[model samples]
Target chain A: MSATLDDLDRRLLWALQDDLPLRERPFAVLAARLGVNEDEVLQRLRRYLAEGIVTRFGPFFQVERMGGAFCLAAMAVPEERFEEVAATVGAFPQVAHNYRREHALNMWFVLAATRPEGIAEVAWAIEDAVSLRVWLFPKEREYFVRLRLRP
Target chain B: MNGEALFVPDERDRALMLATQAGLPLEARPYHALAERLGWAPEEVFARLARLRAAGVIRRIAAAPNHYALGYVANGMSVWDVEDERVDEIGRWLAEQGEVSHCYRRPRALPLWRYNLFAMFHARERSEVERAVAAAAVRLAARFPGAVRAHEVLFSSRILKKTGVRLDF
Candidate 1:
């Protein structure tokens, strides 16, 4: 997958992770820093977004800061019933990211809602839909860490 | 963090969020494009965005690359059962490690689940992730000894869904 990316593309990917300049021509500023033309930068970014190389490309909002809540929930489903449960859980708009992990508690997902109470409400609704106990693990404290993946 | 009042997005803010949640327009003047779409002045759009950022509602205007597409195929959620008293200290320590992307102190479900400290590790290969976690475990044991108990790494087998936070206004 990475073989399709060139040196410029890799650098652009790394650079895009940082905050973009809030100027009239943000792409121009980025292009300058990357030693590329504005058109080239925009073209590559469009391609990246279209190709699924970049999942999202805009403001990263912290729901907590906005008085929203995010909770990590998990459930252990029978192997035969895993797909059904996953589909049911994934149907909820509050489910931001759901993953099938290798553990007794296999179905893990992150729930986000506008209000703190809303998280539990969604979890309960999912529980009702799936007939499985949803264990919510709200973070008591978050340790800060910056992640930058080198391409 | 919960003590602070929530920053409720007004109608305009909600409209702006809905418009830009997918992404900023790839144009010479993205904000202007947004303003035109929302039928607001460009300056108003800029001011609102700046205010939202200052209020911490918007973490940053950035790009989130797909880790798997970037060749980071191995992603592991490392959970540990550390002493309650030292969990914070250990979590802070783990957060400083390059391999640890996110570290948090969460409640442990007794009996079945005993992990309170969670840290995510990502690498190009599963073996590399395992080795990194092993090295971190050894170091953690050396530093905290008895405080560190059982640990497990749950590798993600599949992404059932991954649409980041979509709030219906």
Candidate 2:
């Protein structure tokens, strides 16, 4: 989490969390909306990016809509070689997210791909590359997937 | 068949998808900017975007918030082992909750793991997440009269790698 944010910082974050304006000067427009100077808003955002407060600051796309695919898969990797397996799995451009969880199948990852075949191709590559059968658990339905962490 | 097979995006749509996926150039008249770069009229780009959106190709034209910056420090991956037939009904109900950010039905790894439904809840404290999970359990109980078999919340130990999308796939 970001270190103590002031009132103005919070306001800027809350306001920018929505779709940014599609204009010549978005930050300027946003600053106007937030009642702050354009340079200050841009500087704050730059600082946030540098500080890792903001992982990404831009338009977000729904990859699935573009015929891209994603899935959550897990592996019961050997404790000794967990790091090795995780590194192998994480190397793929298709694997957008990889996490170490607490369970029998402790290693979990989300495979993001541009093509349908790309998903299985990457999954198979990982299976042979790491000597572990990757259990593919593709999403059957997405009930909801919107997140807004209020400041 | 998947949406890809059902709706084949043309060369122009592909260009639009690639452009939009990269985070619309942070500028005013982003659509116009996109058009200028794509060598099409602004209206053409706007119309294409609208069509893509309507087709569920672009779920939304919106901002992706940085949760950590906003104080949602704790992340919980709550999984449930509910009756297979009743999974969707309960999953949708739980997804409607304020706490759940994402909910889905995935194939359960049997015998060893039985959880078939997954919902990720984020908050400042683990207790807050537990309360949300408890409420979900209650929702399951209400709908099917105590049919939820088991559930667990797997808080991520570490985020090895996370980037929401890979457009260059």
Candidate 3:
């Protein structure tokens, strides 16, 4: 679906990237800042979400801060079995983000688990189910970079 | 940093997390709405959220726009096989670039994968992303000659699944 954003929508999208206030009427604060009413802000956000312009709207939790683990993994699935392997791999709840990349290691995914050990367990189970070796590339160090898309 | 010692959410906090995992209610008083849902006072809910934020458990309460819908269709994972001694410095430098969204140093699986540094770049056009990657490589080469052995930009063809880290309650 084509997203034709208006001026207000564009401003709202950009504004929403930052942290919303922790107040009783956070949206009201945002609306006042944007020179719009709270009802308009709510309506626009609802429409954006319904139209899939905004994938999610809420608090972003840091799993690592909560003692969780996240690991990046890759596997090379045969061209013929790519779809099947993807289905099997994506079936796991721990597989947070899976993508088909152009490389020998075609299937790349991220596994997130509550505990550090759960990461390996999920990888092993996925390997057993798909009958393919899963290469785990856990981050040794992370360089900070905030993601902010211009609306 | 020990996350458990930093902030271990008790049963109530877990309930709060479960309630807002999908998202906060789109209301004038979202915290109050959450308070009503969990049968807790608004003040207590706000206090817990503030504590979580302070503890770094919650990064931010914000909106995640759909990149594709926003015209950021080209997503490139730029991997560089840099010298071990300079990877961290180079990774930090790459992280500073505006084009880079995420940068990390990961273990290299020899004989198969040689790249240890990964940086993600997204743009509206594939050529734009490629240009940025090329520019970055040129800058890296100029700054640190012979530090990078090889590099490749792996563009994602499709998103098979994308549910951001849904932890079971």
Candidate 1 residue pairs in clash (backbone atoms < 3 Å): none
State the lDDT at B86 in candidate 2.
83
- For each candidate, report its DockQ versus the true two-chain complex: 0.80, 0.51, 0.77
At residue A78, candidate 1 shows an lDDT of: 96
Which candidate has the top score in TM-score? 1
State the TM-score of the second chain for every model.
0.94, 0.88, 0.94
Worst 10 contiguous positions by lDDT, candidate 1 chain B? B1-10
Number of clashes found in candidate 3: 0
**What's the lDDT for candidate 1?**
0.90
Give candidate 1's error at residue B150 in angstroms.
1.0
Instruction: Tell me which of candidates 1 and 3 scores higher on TM-score.
Output: 1
Q: lDDT for every model?
A: 0.90, 0.76, 0.91
**lDDT tens string, model 3, B140-165?**
99999999999999999888987666
DockQ of 2: 0.51
B20-42 per-residue lDDT for model 2 (tens digits): 66566544456777889989998
Candidate number of the best DockQ: 1
lDDT of 1 by residue, A1-24 (tens): 644899999999999999988899
Tens-digit lDDT track of model 3 for A1-151: 3488889988999999899999989999999999999999999999988888887788888878777888999999999999999999989988988999999999999999877899999999999999999999999999999979987
